[model samples]
Each structure stands twice: as structure tokens, then as C-alpha cells.
Target: MRPKEIQEKLNIDGDRIKLFKREGIFTPENPPSGNRSTNYTDADCEHLRLLVVLTKSGLTCSDIRKLQEGECTLEEAIKIRKNNIDAEIKRKQNALILLSELLADKVEFETFETDHYWNVIAAREAEGEEFINTEDMYGYRAVSLIRSIKCPYCGEEHEVDLEDYMYDESSYEKENGMGPDVVYSFNSEDGYECHECGRIIQIEGWIREYPEGAYDSEDINVVEGEKD
Candidate 1:
């Protein structure tokens, strides 16, 4: 194939082909005629393809020359590239784990301790790493979690109101001369039927909500919502 044909077939630009030629990395096998340009053979095209792969894998011109001269094998170069790619994958996984902890309220963003490596893993300089902050990460996760709760019965991941369905409610009241005081209690043993699937979900013990200043150790302990 001619240079233009090789460029079209291989999807390589003329500048790259020129650079490869100048570096003696992938030369055309055909000798020049009276007025014809140099031509590349099938074998030359195959080597050019390998050169492209090596260059994209961060190998330099000299490295390709070494490989062409039989100084190093393809498997060795691939092993080195594989190791680098594997390390990059591990770094990304660590960042995701850290983000998950913050989202699950396991770590308070403000008090979360991290080293420089963590920051590097979490954000890249090209993505505006300096402006990244985790202060409100927990709050954002809380809201998103509340919205994404899955219905046990139907396995439908959606938001549903349990106010009307919640049962096994009890209230303790004290009527004094001044006024009245009450402590309300709710247990998850009273299951709710899924509106989507019509299956009853026994939540066991999940706190819905509580009135401010109305909770004590007895009330919380009874429902297993708190431990002392």
C-alpha cells in the first residue's frame, strides 16, 4: 500500500507516519522508482500497527527501535503496560471505596482524615482537583439514600411514604394539673404492604421519626433504636 492508502486503512495521520519514517521506526519496504514515492508492504503495515500500539502504551521511539532490533520481546512490553493499567484500576477502586464510606455516613467528611494520595486518587488535576470538597458529602448522600430506598416486597427502588402504613404504635401520656405529656412509640413489627407489589414488609426495627425533646432512654431502648 502507498502512504496515503496506509494512512486511510490504518486510520493514522500523515504527521504520525512521517514521524515514524523519520525515526526509522516503520519504513516502506519498496524502493523508490524514477518518479514514484516509496511503498509499504503488508509486513511493514503489520509492524506499523504494532508501533502504534506500543506508542499509545507510553513506549518511546527508542523503545520501538529496540523491539524491532530484537532487543526486547512484545510480551515483556505488554507485561509492563499491564502492571501500570492494573495499578491505575486499583487506585480508582480505592477512590470509589472512600466515596462510598462518605455516602453511607460511615465517615464524616469534615473530620475524615486522608493523605495526599487519597486526594490524588479521588480527583485528577484536569478535573479541577483543588476545588473538590467533601464537607457536605454526607448530607448529599443522606438525601439520595432516602430517595433510593428499595421496597422489600416488590424489589422496586423508589420513594414511598410509610406514615400511613406504619403501625404497632403506642403512646404514654401523663395528665398533670398544668398540662399533659406524651411519649409516642412505633415498632416495625407492624409490617406495611407494598403498594407496588402487594407484599407485606416486616421492617423489624427502623426508626421513622421522633418528636423533639420527647425521647428518653426507655423509649429508645424499648424500640432498639438506641443502645447505652
Candidate 2:
């Protein structure tokens, strides 16, 4: 294809392509030539497509060309670009919501406390049409997690948002060592102290995931020594 056609595919102009060529984003052999009929091959076009996405998502052409020599795969680059896009979109959405609050003469703009708040906000926005309507938003969410649970030791029900606890636990895991977790289930170590009995209640068998922080709980039990 011609340079104009390739530029149309890449959403870039001739000068930008020239810059890329200068920076070695385009190889010497497979250059996006100006007047050549069969200049860019299928493989070249595909690579240019990937490079366009990478550059749009804030990667330098040099960085992308370096990635080609390393263990980084094309799929990983695409995924990274998608994640960067999502993060930027979410950041803008939060800004819009905050701007709405300012328009309503709200007393204070809430400082960003945790990413958990954003996750919950996403959940709330997805769950509630009411807030969206009130805020006149494309979206916004809030879930009342005033949840209660029965104590395994005391057989008494008490207010305890297990979901909130698990959120913190998962966040800790993410910070510590866990990598790119799509879904994480609770284990025996994930537990909480009972409000009534002061005994630990260990929750097991649950898939905890984001956007919709719903838990599929299997069982609630006391610790080994505590129960015995």
C-alpha cells in the first residue's frame, strides 16, 4: 500500500511516519514508502497497527521497538494499551463525577483515599440508575454494605461487611505479590473476629472479583483451636 493508505490505517500523517522511520519504528527494508504500489507488506501493516496503539497509549516508538527485541509479546502490548485506556477513561469519569458534585455546591471534594473507593464507585454506578439520574450522569454508583453475618461461635448475627474485609485482603495480596489477578478466591487464612463472641470466623470458598464485588461464599467456620 501507499504511504497515504498506510497513514490512514495508522491514523497518522506523513511527517509522523517520517519521524517513526527516523526513530527506527519502521525498518529500512519494509519502509512505508511514499509512491511505491506494494511498499508495506501485510506483516508491516499489522506491526504499524500495533505501534499506533502503543504510541497512542503513551509508549514511545523507541520503547515499542525495544519491546520487539525482548520477551514482550504483541498480545501483551495490546493488553497494556487497553488497560491504559481503561485507567484514563476511569480517571476522567471520576473527574466528571467530582465536577458534578462541585456544580451541586457540595461542601467538599473528597480526596482520593483508596483505589477501593473507585472500585466501589464503579460498582455503585453500575448497580444504581438512581444516582446516575440524580447526578445526570452517564454513570455513578454506591452500595450500602451495612451487611451482617452470623457468628460461627456465638450463633448470633452481627453487622459485618465480609465483602469489605475481603476487598482489603485482596488489595493487600495485590500489593504484596499477586500479579494480574482476574479472580481471587478466599482461603482459610482470610478471616475476621466476631463482634459478639470475639472469636475468629474464617470464611472459605468464595470467588472475589472486581467491578461487581460479589462473593460466592461456600462456608463459614471457626479456627481449629477456637472451635475445639
Candidate 3:
């Protein structure tokens, strides 16, 4: 596993070997001469080959050094890289969904609006802020009002489609008509109705929201011939 032996095994030029060592990708204690050189094992040669491929694929020498030193497991590093890829995929999916809904005339505006309203409400609550006015329940913000609805009979939850339920008649009036003034209304005398299950029970709040993002790109197996 002298330099000459490595060069012969890899079918690479001496200059390439020199370059690899200069890049700190591969190193030998002593340079090979006509009759004197240190030996290298087959495992060392394989490791060097893998390093070359990794470096060519955009990994830096420092990254390789970290791997060599056991600072991070290769599995963990791969997982981190995959997680980032997954986040990007989710972002792209959301953007596509928004764009498609915008372009379609028969899109489910109600569902999207309701989900957005609840998200905002949840965000506010997470920040330790009140979404509703405790004194006058009716004097709350649209977001607050949307969050306060529960079926008196079925106990089914309902959310207001705030975006679709806008007061801007000038814009939407020409399209799919207008929404009700009160985003949510319940009849306590009669139990609320579940939209899905159709059960007659006491409603708590709106449960309809947007679907979670699709699978993470990292988790998705790459198919052969696919160029992603």
C-alpha cells in the first residue's frame, strides 16, 4: 500500500495522489520513492476512495475531519441533512397548495379560512395573550369570535373561515356571495350537529383545519431515474 501501489490500484496519476494528500483527504507519513515507502492496507485505500467521492459531492475537508474524529456520527449528519430537505419540501407543498387554491374557482375557501383563524388563535395563546375579551364576549376580535364556537347538541367543533368570511363585498360579492355577520352561532336549546359524524351532542369548538404537510423529502425514497 505504498504510494505506487495505491496509484496502481486506483489507476490514478501520481499528481492526483499528491493533490489528495495536499487537500488533507489522504495522508501517508512518508513519500514513496523508487524503493522506499510506507505500506497502506486495502481498507485505507477504500476509505480514501470514499473520501474522494464525498469531497466531490460537496463535502469539505473539515467535514471529513469531523467524521474522522468521531465528533458526529455519519447517521446523525445524514439525518440533519435530511431534516433540512424535508422542511424545504413542506414549504414547497404549502406554497403549491396556496397557489392551486387561489387559481381554482371551486376551492374549499371555508376550510382554509377556518384553519388559518385557529392557527392565529393558537399562536396568540402560546404567546400568553388572550384572543378574546373576557368582559364582553361579543366585543372580541374576529379571530376570538371564530374560536369561541361549540355545538350545543353534538359537541362537534366548528371553525370560522375568516379569510372567506370577509366583509369586503366589493371584491367577493361578484363571486361566491357573502358570509354571515356572525362567524359562529350555536343554539344551546338544541344540541349542536357534527358535520362529519352527524352526532347530536354538545359541541366544544371547531376542529376542521388544514391538513398537515406532506411527507418529508428525506423520508421519501429516491426512485431510480428520478432527477430530484
What are the models' TM-scores?
0.34, 0.32, 0.28
Where model 3 places Cα greater than 4 Å from the true spot, the runs are: 29-39, 76-228
Model 3 TM-score, all chains together? 0.28
Per-residue lDDT over 80-123 for candidate 1, one digit per residue giving the tens place of the 0 to 100 score: 76775666565566567657766776666677657744665546
Candidate 2 local Cα displacement, residue 153, angstroms: 98
Q: In candidate 1, what residue range of length 10 has the lowest lDDT sum?
A: 138-147
Q: Each candidate: what lDDT?
A: 0.52, 0.53, 0.46
- Give the distance in Å from residue 32's predicted Cα in candidate 2 to where it truly belongs: 11
> Which of the two, 2 or 3, has more TM-score?
2
User: How many clashing residue pairs appear in each of the predictions shown?
Assistant: 0, 4, 16
Residues 1-228, candidate 2: write the lDDT tens digits: 766787787778755555565466665345312112237767777877776777876676656776877857767766776785566666667667766755665444465345644565678668742122322333222222335556666787765433333333342335544322334333334345655666666654344333333333334333422555
- Report model 2's TM-score to 2 decimal places: 0.32
Ranking by lDDT: 2, 1, 3
When 1 and 3 are scored with TM-score, the better candidate is 1
User: Residue 2's C-alpha lDDT in candidate 3?
Assistant: 71
